[model samples]
Target chain A: MSFKPDHEIYRRRFSRNLGVGLCLVAFVMLGFFLTVEKVTRGNPLDALQGKPYVAAPVAP
Target chain B: MTDIQAQATPAEPGFGDFVQLLKPRVMSLVVFTALVGLMVAPVHLYPVAGFSAILFIALGAGASGALNMWWDADIDAVMRRTRNRPVPSGRIQPCEALGLGVALSGISVVMLALATNLMAAGLLAFTIFFYAVVYSMWLKRLTPQNIVIGGAAGAFPPMIGWVAATGSMSLEACLMFALIFMWTPPHFWALALFMKEDYSNAGVPMLTVTHGRRATRVHVLVYTLLLVPFAMALGWMSIGGPVYIAAAAVLNVWFVVGAVRIWRRDEVQAEADKYAVEKAFFRFSLVYLFAHFSALLVEAVLRAQVYGV
Candidate 1:
């Protein structure tokens, strides 16, 4: 059992969006993966041990 | 944050409730496929890295479940099948589920990024987002096509595993993704067919609730038709071999025949045995998915030992 489409309108949107979302999501996924790989691969604990993504506030 | 924490103090949740929050059955499938994905990839993972990667992925899956339970508690309370879940049973508060889910999501993603490549971590992130936000929050309540789109969340673990091993996606990885994505509709719909009253009671607008059983039966046949080729095709891809192809052929023949029987059932025939065909088909759906993925793993092992691939 599944959804009853209100009409063919969602049917069309569903089909189109599945394709669009697949590609968009895949692209972002790959981009994020590569970026993280570049930043983190050398050391598992680097985030903990090294400088943060943002600099700590300077002492007054 | 303080207000939410305040609510958790009044009720003590046992260890089992926390375990239940993870939805272990679903996690096991995630672990299985992700392991297969990693093992079959051209590049292998270190034992420790592999273990860690899988741990994080399972956590990600658990995170999605927690978030889903948190969000769906209202409708869940209405469905007999889901009414006893931790949140609705009052074993844990919604805020606790939400907090646990969000915390696990961040921890799993960050740790996976550390343990594997960015790609695997990113895929895990998308998977959680897809299940929690896209599937749970939006598509589920709004469409009868909910499972169709939401199935993608379940489909990502294998690909994430492959990425973990190779630090990149490949044809084999995509095929694994396609295999699960294609398999989800029929699998879930089969359950929906038998559990129609639960959907009706819960006001969930499932296919049986909206389209009626006849249409759902036909849809099962049609989707099963679509699924077979995609499944068999993987036999010819980098991941495929004689063993996998042979297993796929046998499994799919049974699957299609079952779907056809389901499609052929009329109200009279179905009611005679209380949806026996539908129920049988639902049972087969589980075997159908597990068999295919297991076949892939078997082929990989065979090749490793025999063919030296």
Candidate 2:
């Protein structure tokens, strides 16, 4: 089967961009958590004010 | 027609071309605002489901982006700012973008429904349609009010987030949507003010192009005034706290002042200044939304710690 020149070019570009994007995503995720730990004194979630933990009222 | 026949385009499609297809800049706003919506709502979902729902929301936003790119490739090619986007640059075919958009839209909406609720999924689907079809294909060329009405599509993410958690909408959630909706006109029109030539060249009916810069400036000032009260009301609703109220008050005062400055400036001064006032307001608008939402998060935290709302 003859390969179209444009198809090969598109495939190469797509793969390259996908690889770059994946690397950036990993870096951001890792950097974000690391920054959170360093800034929040090692309890990253602690820095976030979580939703209130309200228990259901008992039926009378 | 002549350009299409020349050498069949020899420039090698690069990695950046494909990345441009996703419209990363617009996607960031959707993700941030949606996350804020999810966080501030007075409801909860299981951690895994919540994560999945948000992921699907992001995909839906991406779908909208792809479709917008496919449809607007013609105008995008003409506009200097958009000329190098994936579709126009020949890195990706328009049909491929359309296929990706349709596939992602279906996946996102279905997954959201299963993970969250039907209502949230419905809203997400409508948002994608509104942006891709209503705004991009329909209103963009027909009316100067394009951004004003189309801004609703961008505004829906937060409300969808709130609905994802609560399975319904509330005054607080709607206000967040309204705040962004009203803010979009001035924010975009400001860019339009500076980039009027780009819109005119592309045959887009931006306010600055269709109605003239002076009229556009007045509209910016009017909308900025409207945004202030809506932003403050979020604070009053207990959706925010002292931090948010203070931030909104100060930001809004400065914002209005900026808009008024742009409005009152003489055309000669405005032309020389160009994007200065508008640019400041635009940059500040980014901080304004972030600060308001950050305040909400802070208020939520404080309430959790002290009053336990």
Candidate 3:
């Protein structure tokens, strides 16, 4: 049996799948940035290296 | 000839249907007020943090919207205004909305804690619970003063934003909360005056349905009168500036005049005018909120730019 590329089901489901896919991608990016912000600002790694993690003074 | 294709196609839910489950218009208000709240706080947040904080709060608000749809599906189906919502119209399953609300509520609260602070997260969690359970399930069906109390749920975002930024509460944040809380009654009562039939048909005890339109109109004026002090006080607070005070003065005058007009009209006169005054008041209430918040935001920007606060 041959599969049709433009089936009705495919057309119906495409947008929903694409939206969920985009949201997941965006969430991953948000997580990456959040981690980077936390680590860079406080230098949490300093604590792991036997040093205190002093929070950087935040800008107004 | 194409028997398989001729079979009736079940109505399939789409992305937009799911988004509708989130009540995007309400989410817009949530996003705007929360942004203003975050901006006006004394401490500045890193751009990414600020964005994430607002996004999570919006998500929490949207999650509650979904839960409200789930709970209110019956009343929603009866009400003309909400009859076509995703769940009530059968595009999305009630269980799906429930699951989405629960999952997003958990995710938003946890992510907010991670992105901002525990206080902000706690407030978001409480807000979701207040909206979904206390307001939607209990207060909405039980009392004419439903939105009056339920307005607290919508009033929370700015306080959450403030807490997210300052990691604590202040009078400024409370003032912003009070402004929205006070504004909600008149805003909704105006809508209720026009949409009385929907609330009556849905068996919801809106003030217009229970206390008569005349009483609802009086309540609108009284609430509008009460709301003015909160708005003016916020203007005089540290966050308030010349811009905000001026805006508040003008907006309050217009708002009070609108409320008084609403109060003075009898149903016969209102019907003669096709409820024009009520509809105008409803539209202006949206502007009243947006302008007030915008003024606060403008003051924050000016302070940051000029005084470098």
What order do you get sorting by TM-score, best first? Answer: 3, 2, 1
Superior by TM-score: candidate 2 or candidate 3: 3
Q: Compared with the true structure, what per-residue lDDT tens digits does model 1 show for residues B1-309?
A: 355534333445655677688899999999999999988888887565787788889999999999999999998899998899999988789999999899999988997897788989999999999999999999998888998999999999999999999999788898889889989999889899878788888777688888988988888999899998889988998878998999899999999999999899887898889988888888888888898899889888988999898
Identify the CAPRI category of the predicted complex in candidate 3.
acceptable
Task: Provide per-model DockQ scores.
Answer: 0.02, 0.12, 0.43
Where does candidate 2 stray beyond 4 Å? A1-60, B1-18
DockQ of prediction 3: 0.43
Predicted model with the maximum DockQ? 3
lDDT for B131 in candidate 3 is 98
In model 2, how large is the Cα lDDT of residue B14? 60
| Lowest summed lDDT window (length 10), candidate 1 chain B | B1-10
lDDT of 3 by residue, A1-60 (tens): 987678565665888999999999999999998887686674545666766566568999
lDDT of 1: 0.86
Task: Looking at model 1, give its docking quality level.
Answer: incorrect
Ranking by lDDT: 3, 1, 2
Pairwise DockQ winner, candidates 2 and 3 = 3
Model 3 Cα displacement at A27 (Å)? Answer: 0.4
Q: What is the TM-score of chain B alone in each candidate?
A: 0.96, 0.93, 0.97
Root-mean-square deviation (CA) per prediction? 14.5, 8.2, 4.2
Model number with the top TM-score: 3
